[model samples]
Target: MDYDSVRTVDTAVADALIGERERQEETLAMIASENHVSEAVLEAQGSVLTNKYAEGYPGERYYAGCAYADEIEQLAIDRATELWGAEHVNVQPHSGTQANQAVYHAMLDPGDKILSLELTHGGHLSHGHPANFTGQMYTVEQYEVDPETGRIDYDGLAELAESFGPDIIVSGYSAYPRAVDWERIQAAADAVDAYHLADIAHITGLVAAGVHPSPVGIADFVTGSTHKTIRAGRGGIVMCDAEYADEIDQAVFPGGQGGPLMHNVAGKAVGFKEALTPEFEAYAQAVVDNAETLGETLVDHGLSLVSGGTDTHLVLVDLRDSHPDLSGGDAEDALTEAGIILNGNTVPGETRSPFDPSGIRAGTAGLTTRGFDGAAMEEVGDLIYRVVDNHDDEAVIEEVGERVLELCADHPLYAE
Candidate 1:
């Protein structure tokens, strides 16, 4: 139970580790795809279940003494299924990318066509980034966001689907701030006879809590990470209709991954149970409210936001008007120096490279989980403006970093 005793070895390494924890505690984590897991989830993740080698599903494990492992894994699957109304749930994939890969391996042949959102326009790399295995093995047709509105161009997607006739259509993103019209996407996929896949990795917690619309029943396959807003351990899950159960399970086990991480699965079970609580629903709603407030504050500060605003926990800030001289990379570095952590993101139709994008992505999941409200967000917004506006001001950065630590102390993420 003593993480300090377990993680701390040599004095230097222990000091560094302690410092890292202190940094996470003091800084606001605004990454859209990140969250702080509860102590219960952490306990489950660090449990003795990690020693087990449950290579297959319950009752068919490759190793002995898997009774507890089987129970935990089944509990995770049942909870995931109940939470999402999924007919079948596979809680074995190591990460979201792995879950997507398993689905691809299960359903598609080599060189099959996949229609997905463009990477620069808020899509995940596993959805078909050229450098990823999905893109290298499959023929990919990318749909894009509308240049003017910065929203999904559904009409353009339909046009692409008609022309390309892809075998699968992926609908989701890592940084998109708007709610997708799942029905429209499903209709488009249906029209082209393409399988619909929704990778709701960013908004899975919101969806489960009813703060965002669920894609469980609409999409043929639903994929998500347990950690994001779900506040679970680091792992991925796949859910689908009962018809695809056998194929999906086989693909995940013998096809894509080896043994399942039972300890993480236990953490997932705990997370899912928490998500089912009313308190978790309130937390999910708080994430959206905090994000909206943050986005409005950014806009009021003269920063351009992609899609003008957000309907979810994340915001993509386009800095072309506010900081024409600065790139997203510059903003990220400056903000990190100020103890406000976030990522530089590429806006749709960005001319800059991905490494130094034109926009920055921020989220409210971590802050909201730490109980930060609208007022706190407004203050955080001012800090962000200061950092972005005065990237070279070491004094200002140090001052804001101190303020960040103060704010973090006021609303500590974990009770001491």
Candidate 2:
């Protein structure tokens, strides 16, 4: 991951790059939304294709020198189709947020009703959080998980859809822990005459590996990021039935973006190809198993998990019961000091600000990418709990920090 070529002209940037690589090499990346991509995907993302300006779909670009662009984009689409079985796939959207934007442009008008999960309730900002454009431009209503179960309240969502008369309903989530019932949500949308848009941005690889149920055939529109669980560098994709293909394409290009990042598309192609391997399935399964182990470890140490456990790659820990005086932000800072990287999150029925909420969210995707197994994750879970439980103890922080470095070194990333 050294930048020797860039170091020739830009020593400053090269220093920052080297520092970031060393940081990743030394710490635990427990952030749910982040993952390490393969060197092949990295190479493709930095390929010469970045200089191209492919403004449209394959073989139909506005530019003349796009034959290579067409070839790479089609391969991305083909591999993605084989992975998720979406009748139509558009890899042009710049991110998962932009992918959602394309769906809205294609299927919704300004001021259309959008019924989605609340931001503090495991939903993403693009799903109608007030700070996002979706909230300002659209009529937005939100649903929440059951306080008792910490799982999506399907009946409540259905009733809300019926009452709100939404034009669209969004499913999938960013911080949720349990497996989703996409069919039930689709039925709710159907009952309300609303389109179902499943944003599987965080679980794309799990779905592709069949570790999680897919929303491709059930939802009216399906969108995801390329890097979360799939390790496809960084990009977004929109998929739908053939009938909505052209609408999605147009929405993505003239509607939401101009020139496609051809290099990112190449990265997506390479990563999708990697995901198709049989070994990827084992990797995906290990991710879930590791999460389960981590969750159990926390619970065993008297930390409370939001969903009681996890069926996905991440877990949300509601710290109020075990450490009422400690804020999630404090816990986050303490863990960071201990070389564990994660984020403060708002739990359901949050009584704290988003900045210093009542919960911490962590994931095993990055650790699993570094080849962490059940035992390794259990130790990680122990270290995380120790840091959170004794957040103020400098001695504990120092000890955990050393252990984290040892773990990182044991499971070396990007080893030459």
lDDT of 2 by residue, 1-416 (tens): 67999999999999999999999999999999999999899899999998999887898889999999999999999999999999999998889999999999999999999999999999999999889999988999999999999999999999999899999999999989999999999999999899999999999999999999999899999999999999996989999999998899989989988999999999999999999999899999999999999999999999999979999999999999999999999999999999999999999999999999999999999999999999999999999988988899999999999999999989999967
* Candidate 1 clashes between residue pairs 3 or more apart in a chain or in different chains: none
lDDT digits (tens) for residues 1-416 of candidate 1: 22477455566766776677788898999988889889899889989998888999998999899999988888888888778899999999999999999999999999999999999999999999999999899999899999999899999999999999999999989978999999899999999999999999888899999989998999999999999988877889999999999999999999998988888899998889888899999999999999999999989889999999999999999998888889999999999989999999999989899999999999999999888999999899888988888899999999999999999999887766
Q: How displaced is residue 39 in candidate 2, in Å? A: 0.6
TM-score of 2: 0.99
For every model shown, what is its TM-score relative to the native structure? 0.98, 0.99
- Quote the positional error of residue 387 for candidate 2 in Å: 0.4
Q: What local distance difference test score does each model get? A: 0.92, 0.95
- The Cα RMSD of model 1 versus the native structure comes to 1.3
Q: Candidate 1's error at 387, in angstroms?
A: 1.2
Candidate with the greatest lDDT versus the true structure: 2
